[model samples]
Target: MFKNGVFYYYTVLSILFCLLSCNSDSSKPFEDFFNTTVSTEKELGYAVEIEKIALDHIESSSYIGEIGYLKDNIAFVDYRFCWVFLFDYEGNLIDKKIGHGKGPNELFIGRISGFSFLSNGQSLFHEASNRVFVFDNNWKKIKETRINWKGSQKYGKARNIKRPSAKEPIIYSPDFGNLKFKNFNKKCYFPIYSEHSNFNGLMGGYKYYKEGRILAELDLSNYSDINILRLLGRRTPELLNYSYLPHHSTFNFDIDSKGFFYIAHEIDSLIYVYDHDFNIKYAFGVEGENMDTNYKELKKHDVKKFRELFFNDRPKRGYYSDIKVFESNDQNLLVFRSYRKSISSAYDGLQIYKNKKLIVDTEVPKGFEVKYYKNGFYYSNGTIEEEEEKISFYKLKLYHSVF
Candidate 1:
């Protein structure tokens, strides 16, 4: 009896010990969880490197589609004239041809949203009709397939309405290709915006197309809604003015090579990292500002004043526009672009981040837009000289150790 009693006692003690160890929070320090370092020096400052690429007669209009680089040093760019032009690395136009034509059921001078070089040495261009046109190396159309637009009804209902009209079929922008992935399926994710909402917002949905038919549809409405709020609040100050809520949110929505999802939502400005199965793994970020106590309590007449205080309370400087993960030196580095105010103007400088740390800051040349590229960042001055009507491209050199 004593032997059995002792064994039971030991078993109970073992279970209790296990529970204590499992519930222990002593090892995980609060500082390790939350990054509280506010360094001005580590903050990004802009530097410019100017190199001119010759273009004889590039159009003045802003182009939407991507510029693809082939293995043979060929650059393919979309022109507003319903054509894709092939150019050499030296900015000399090599060949240009019609990508699409106006027909009974064909695209009519539609804008190209994305251009990609497929693994088979072919090119894929996503057009306005939710279709991807495949082309050979010589800019010849090989095949065309419509991209599936998944969750149209759910996306429509979110806006308190049915599907969009034929004339206004919730057209998608090329930014969908901006979602980073090593290998892209013959699929496209579209962002649908609710016209009825008081706030300008949208949801992300995807359609998978194989052969000539849509094979599958994925509804990302729930996940997209969660992300939309965070995206809206972070980028646009005007939206934050309406909500006037103290806490802001951040979501890191990423797709892996296998098309699985990775989402990290920042609740009350506190980050929560989740994998495709919605399992929480890690989190980091600052807590939301105390709106009630921090801002002066004033009645309805002070609405504008209230908004100013609310947006001002948060760290206005460090907001990121987008984040992408890429393989570098066998380690996955998360690259993100951020904007900072220039001493002269607002939103003038560009900052790059890797692994949640600032790495590079490319300065804008008086007036220019900086875009993130795979190898480096591209800067373009939006001005078009009437006589020249040519666009300029500047490449920024990155220091790798910053990641």
Candidate 2:
């Protein structure tokens, strides 16, 4: 009788111990059990056709903002924060005017976070803020209207705004390239912040972090009124285990010719596809080989610790960067770019999906993004040289006869 009683007591203690362990380690969900990795099929063969475009005029800073195409022959590059360099398809310098100024044509603070060319001979620019600027084809500012986004604070002056802590990210915005600034029939979309998203992201236990909304739309019919897209960065399970940096929490969006919108969050492998109405139609994705997820988790809402983790460890880690979809020769191609995470390496993951089926899951040149696709060719800016005057770009062509 005594032996049986001791055995039952030990079994009860063991069960309690198991329950405690599971509760303490609740951050890792079921998906965390599988470290999924993807690689190109052995039979697939890919090549990058390199083409460099030279500029005739002098270039300014190395910072290249979003590039906007006004026509088949006209293009403009947002040069740094002060100027917009306009050129043609043949690389002819057209204009170097229109920048930060108090003039009628100039902006008080000229920053092109994203842009979309309108069909009615006008251009729209979003500075990652609530306001949208409209200008004529001549680059003269026509009107600037503040969007009607409720629960959004006005980013009036830098000094007036409150910060979560000193030396932290002032704002977290992901609408970087032209791909992110999309235009459909009567509505246009741009990436905006989640009002203290960076700080909120650190507090993973809160409800706001689980329900963060990142994208917003501007209706040309009613320019003042705008609607924020659905909650984007939903608690992607893998991200829960680590300290979510503001940048890693960012995402990019693009719209295909079929009017299907695609969003790729930085920390997720799933590419969310939405119809014109912004409804979640489906999700498809492919993760990189040897992607790292073992990041330091910040349980406390400490801004200093989060900054230290981002600066020290974020560089050596790989994460999804952006997604872009384009059509080539009657074929629809979707590409997802990811950082290889090697601080000294130049290899980024480029997964090419042809018609929703991944045909090429291979590594390509670092920063080898498809800038613009035209006439059966894809173009991307080459690494900018601070000392070299002429700007260069790489024209990439993917051969599919092997696959």
Candidate 3:
């Protein structure tokens, strides 16, 4: 009789738990915030200190390709020559060129995608054909490692996959061949995609995409001639529903000086914290004020319908754009860019987290997407239209009164 009572008690408890879950809101992935040891308290009196600037296109828009902020200079991939152009801080062109090759037969570069000066400031690196080419400041090739991408797979046959109706930049941007190398040079994070990814981001009747490898890491370092094993984050069981959702698959991440990884997905509000091995530690983030999260579902649409859906949902809706990490006043800082429907200005909204706690969330001037951080100041390449006659970049600095 005593054993029967114990079993009954546990069964009753499980029934109650299941009922609660079923009654809960299942429409969204995370209806509540995830704060494991973190707290969310908006400290007043902290404001985003901003300085303004203007842009009047200096050269033909074609010169604009990939842009990066070096410590003292700015680098641009001049497509005319298919090489990198390092310019002075004043936006004036400089003679310093990094890679000069245009095709596979060139010396060091082939089908160039992007390049940046590493954090060490002594070496430069560029991506081409799934390989990273590291170069010394004097422009000498030092290391080349081919990324073993095990997640890309062909979906249906080419004829079976659907294509978008929209034109360039809106319905599709084919320039995504290179991996995303935001700030970290020692490591980089890239998204997983279907081999038929060129078929306009997503289609219908697919069970999964790319084995759910949402994020993959490339250890672009060799410590004492020892190569660290690459990390593949296949943690995407929660993503299959929204896996190929438009404008939300791309994830943003950063590795702090402590070696902990911080990742923010486009559709979700939670910011996940992970250890060096990519094990999720905890997550903490509050949704931005006056944001839109009602994303459109996928339908088997041809090009025209796809274009209409994409344009209608892209700008009016809200999503996180990019994230960056910095060290300020001996405290770690995390800043991420977000788009909001409530804001009328063209400037993107940014949330600042000091020491893993949010202090301020506000918008800066247009073109303030941070590209470089130096001497306690955050710098950006600024939002400049290539068609505009000229352009200029501004430096951003955040001020906290409490800290």
TM-score of each: 0.50, 0.72, 0.69
lDDT of 2: 0.58
What does candidate 3's lDDT look like per residue over 1-403, in tens digits? 9999999999999999887665432211322223256556555557767665543334434545656777677766543444555667656776545445533323354445655566776443445445656666655566656554332222223324355211111222212532455335566555444434544345543333322334444466662231223433433233457534644565666677767777777666667776665555777677776666667656554556545656666556667666677665656566555445333546557787765567777765533466677776677764545665344667677776665
Identify the candidate with maximal lDDT: 2
Sort the candidates on TM-score, descending order: 2, 3, 1
lDDT of 1 by residue, 170-222 (tens): 32222342322122344323223223332222211211000011011222222
Tens digits of per-residue lDDT for model 2 on 140-192?
A: 88777765543344444333554432112223344453236677766776664
* TM value for model 2: 0.72
Q: How close is candidate 3 to the true structure, as a TM-score?
A: 0.69
Cα lDDT for residue 198, candidate 2: 35
Using lDDT, rank the candidates from best to worst: 2, 3, 1
Candidate 2 regions exceeding 4 Å error are 1-46, 57-64, 73-76, 79-81, 119-121, 128-130, 151-179, 196-199, 223-235, 243-247, 290-293, 328-333, 336-338, 387-390, 401-403
What is candidate 3's local distance difference test score?
Answer: 0.54
lDDT of 3 at 317: 68
Alpha-carbon lDDT, every model: 0.39, 0.58, 0.54
Residue 340 deviation, candidate 3, in Å? Answer: 4.4
The candidate, 2 or 3, that scores higher on TM-score is 2
- Using TM-score as the measure, the top candidate is 2
- Total colliding residue pairs, candidate 3: 10
